[model samples]
Target: MGMKVGIIGCGSITKFRHAPEYRANPHVDEIVFFDRNLQRAKELAQQFGGRSVETIEELFNDPTIVAVSDCSSNEAHHINTAQALLHGKHVLCEKPLAISVKHAEEILKAQAASGKKLMVDHNQRFTKAHQKAKEIIDKKELGEVLTFKSSFGHQGPESWGVDKSNATWFFKKERSHSGVAGDLGIHKIDLIHFLLDDEIEDVHAFYAALDKVDENGKPIEVCDNVVCALKTKKGRLGTASFSWTYYGSEDNSTTIYCQKGILKIYHHPEHQLIVETKDGAVIKYELEPIQTNENQTSSGVIDAFIDCIIHDKEPSVTGQQALASLKVIEKILGENGI
Candidate 1:
């Protein structure tokens, strides 16, 4: 028998990634969908051949659900995850874990107490380019990774949301914690830690809300651009930048500098890698076209999480690892007065 799964939020992410992925996975015997918006949940349940629950409590109380996926907003992450774990269900939460380190820690505490697996969806870590980069670094091909730089940014959430009104929540600091940094920067931070296998010892960051405001004159508290310099425990120095004001379609890239060579991963125009070795050998690996369902990236992440649950195996990106990334985010917000 396959593990039964429930999704806590039936919003854009559920429609795009989780539902389709769960439906596609044979290891998922059943999927229970929940959302504050009953119509949305019912629609998703109908489309994905899953059952719909009206409330999160109903989903949690169902004895058949072996795991729950929290795809709610930044503020709801901890609460939803805690409730799932308390109900004796494994949890897979979307990135940043929570709006603050304190909330994230609480979720971790719940995980420990419940003895349930908790995973964070840091999908960039699972990408082929990043995986190949880790392999090369582990092989010592890059010598010592002395410095790292990464960035993840896109036009704003307005383009991705189901309703334009949905984008307004992203501009409120109370709802989002911070703007581009939390939304996009957290991914880059997690990637930096994963690839270098190092922790950020300290961070000095600068953030600005240069653009992305409403029709009204009120200033949007969330930042649109952020840049930070970091010191790693392994003595490696690094920098990261994120922005929602980018005029281009999307820009997600990373560069690593080591004693012997340099590695670059580009996500836009082409998902390709470039490497230049000390011996004057240059190599390029062009990524194959990615086939995504309605929400391809999120679907990939969900499949991996389901596999971990059924196999009783550790997730590719653990909650604790995601917490490490959240710490960096907290440091940045503290420094910038956000």
Candidate 2:
């Protein structure tokens, strides 16, 4: 029998990635959708051939649901995920596991106690360019990755939200924690860790609210841009930046410098990779076209989680691994007094 699954949020991410992917997977027997806005959940359920759940509690109380996906706002990640685990359901939570390190730890503690799988949807690691780059780096073709530079920035949340209200929760520190750093930076953080297979030791960071204002013409509490220099435990050095006020097109790029050569992955260029060796040997790779739905790309993350649950294997990105990235975000925020 296929595994029964439920989704805890009906946000853009759910509409774009999770629900469609789950509907396509034959291994998923049934899907139950839930959202604070019951109408949204019902709409998505009808479109996806799933059932609409009125409340989180109702979803968890169902014995058929073997797993739950937490796609809620950042503040609700821990609570929703912990509750799912306590109900003996595996969880696949969206990125940045929790807003704060302490809250993330609390969720981790709950996972340990519950003995259920908790995966984080760090989907960037599953991209073709990233997987290829990781292979090259692993073979030492890049020859001891000495330094790396990565970034993820976009036009901002209002471009994607359905509500588009006067008060975007992303602009509020209380609801979203840090803005661009938490939204975009965390992706790069997870990417760096995945590519290098190392943990960050320490970070020195700077952030600014360069161009955002609230309804009353007051500067928003969250930072619009952030930059950080990091040192990894294995002695690798790296620098990264994230911004939400880019104004232009979305920019997600990474460059790795190693003892022998350099590699570049540019997402807008459509997974193109450019490599330059120390001897001036250059090679370029044109990756296969990625399939996206509703402006969001649904890669192997959802499938991987399903495989993990079916085969009793570990997920691609575990909650503990996500907590590590969240710790770096917290460090950056604490350093900046956010």
* Cα lDDT tens digits for candidate 1, 1-338: 78789998777777887788888888887889888889988998889888898878888999889989898888888899998999999999987799988899999999999999999988788777788889898898879998988877777776666665524667877778777888889988888989988999799888988877754766678888999999999999988989887777577788999899899887444546788888889888876433322225533787888778777899888888999999888888895443
TM-score of every prediction relative to native: 0.94, 0.95
Cand. 2 TM to true fold? 0.95
lDDT of candidates 1 onward, in order: 0.82, 0.86
Report the C-alpha lDDT of model 2 over 1-338, residue by residue, as the tens digit: 88789999898789888999998898997889999999999999999989998888999999889999999988998899999999999999998799888889989998999999999998888888889999999999868999999888777786676665436778888888879888889988999999999988799998988887866778889998999999999999999999888788677889999999899888446447788899999888888444322256668899999999888998899987898998888878775533
Candidate 2 residue runs with Cα over 4 Å from true position: 267-271, 289-294, 335-338
Model 1 regions lying over 4 Å from their true place: 165-167, 215-217, 267-271, 289-299, 335-338
RMSD of 2: 1.8
